[model samples]
Target: MIEVKNTGKPDERRDFPRGHLDVLDLTGLNFGVATFDPGWRWSESLRELAGTDSCQTHHNGYVLQGHLRIRMDDGEEADVGPGDVFVVPPGHDAWVVGDEQVMVFDFAGGMAEYAKAKG
Candidate 1:
């Protein structure tokens, strides 16, 4: 098991809409850290990352700050705020809830098995 302390490693930047993202921890678990800048929006192309309706994985995370809106493939949505812990299943999509920057710790690397279903 590897422990990741946010303070130790420098965040790697990735381009997003209206803002940017710092991605880390993509070694084995496929899991990574994401820091969303204010008013940030994920690329629509990433919608494909949602896998498929049947593909499912359990995701647990804590919101460091700000809020986020999670939209499931079935059109279900949830608004998450600071200090909130969330679990996301398969067939879902998410985005920043407001203008506040969102810091998220996520675990979903195991879901790669669903890749075949993506096509």
Candidate 2:
């Protein structure tokens, strides 16, 4: 089977401080295009809405623009930027790396609930 979807017409959109997520729900995947503006941080922006100490959503993503820094609960951390593909497990905090905005194509399941209100 084959499927085609456009980001221009996302199935759903979630907006948060300094960022927004546009998702396309496919048969076996919930793909998303996440855009984070300068100074965006998961803890400072989305944590309250998520009701978690850190993000609990896993991400398989490809960085399309700018840079992002992810720090895990165990103190492991890394930075993803343009031309980088990354996998981030649950229990992490992320933030935009610089003054530039960040854009990522999330092929994993995280976007399915990213930025949504908890409970």
Candidate 3:
């Protein structure tokens, strides 16, 4: 897979929710990479429910910059930062830590699938 970098140029990028994945595509499976800036954060609402967990698929990824935290279904938490790789299970939540931006790459298509699958 190829690697790409985010320039962190605010004016050049479009605005998105504070805790949301801005990009999603099958091609990313081969080049799972992302660059988070300053206040970027992952959504917690995407985690799979326990008893009613859906047929969701999750994959781990590595952090290229800053830091992030993942909260599992059982309430276990983990911290990740530059050069750190992490696996996001089917049932969990995640977000950025402090004011630093977080960059992440993933091999799995990711949580946004629920909406597309439902639609």
Q: Pick the candidate with the highest TM-score.
A: 2
TM-score of 2: 0.96
TM-score for each prediction?
Answer: 0.61, 0.96, 0.58
lDDT winner between candidates 2 and 3? 2
lDDT of 1 by residue, 1-119 (tens): 66564623634554444444344444565444566666554334243454343325466777778887877768888988888888887666666776788877666664233222244
> How many residue pairs clash (N, CA or C atoms closer than 3 angstroms) in each of the candidate models, in the order given?
0, 0, 0
- Using TM-score, rank the candidates from best to worst: 2, 1, 3
**Per-residue lDDT of 96 in model 3:** 72
User: Regarding TM-score, does 2 or 3 come out ahead?
Assistant: 2
The regions of model 3 sitting more than 4 angstroms off are: 1-15, 19-32, 35-57, 111-118
Looking at model 2, residue 58 earns an lDDT score of 95
Worst 10 residues of 3 by lDDT: 46-55
Task: Estimate the lDDT of model 3.
Answer: 0.54
Among the numbered candidates, top lDDT falls to 2
